[model samples]
Target: MTGSHGLAAAQKGVQDSGNPTHFNFFRSALRGRQRVLWCANDPTVCLDREKNPWGGSTCCYQRFCKDTMSDPNHCGACGKTCAYGFVCCNGNCVDIQNDARNCGACFEECPGQSRCFYAMCDYGG
Candidate 1:
């Protein structure tokens, strides 16, 4: 469906509020008469990955908050970010002491102070 953020099931199919029948606050519930349930554990199974604002698809979600690959706020959860400044750390965006990209962000980070370690910064000064 384009995988845009805030794209609720109501938009794609339903014509009512988010109060779908199979919808749940903590789980991936079905929606509309054409109920199709996939894996509830992972968001990707159901929610389509968002495309990058610039173009093409984003490696993660529109807002780091939505991405299932690297979201800490929702860390293995939903609508979450990598915990403040931290990025996805080990299945979640966590503070990385040695991470160049997220080095100082988690510890004592500063611009240019860290270098991206495997995509994250490593701010260890």
Candidate 2:
């Protein structure tokens, strides 16, 4: 009951009030004991208390990600966006290694006679 089993137990315990509910889970000092708190439809609360105890609303999360490493809209920091087909890598948006549009750098297109291979244009037929 330490992984998916624990998650399933929590999910099963959720109540359906149908009014935009939020729940926060806190681990108590007692081993194997967790505190579950349900809040009304409020905008100034976050799942992780350390990050945002009170600020904005759930809409703030719709466009924001707490984890910056992989978020396309906030790669490394808020307001940093990655273009389509590009992924965030180490705080930077980079093209795929074999992408046809951006082979090695931004806007670096592969010629019609060549294809991108591992971020390089390969002309070998």
Q: Count the backbone clashes (under 3 Å) in each candidate.
A: 23, 0
* Residue-pair clashes, model 2: 0
- The local lDDT score (0 to 100) that residue 28 gets in candidate 2 is 23
List ranges where model 2 is wrong by over 4 Å. Answer: 1-65, 98-125
* Model 1: per-residue Cα lDDT over 25-117, one tens digit each: 324522332233333344343454342221111123332323344446445545555645566643467656456534545443435644655
Candidates' C-alpha lDDT = 0.44, 0.55
User: What TM-score, computed on C-alpha atoms, does each candidate reach?
Assistant: 0.26, 0.33
| C-alpha RMSD for every candidate | 14.7, 12.9
Q: Residue 78's C-alpha lDDT in candidate 1? A: 53
- Poorest lDDT segment (10 consecutive residues) of candidate 1: 51-60
**Residue-level lDDT tens digits of model 2 in 43-116:** 23334465453222212345332334555666666557888977766566877677767687657788886788
Give the per-residue Cα lDDT of candidate 2 at 51: 47
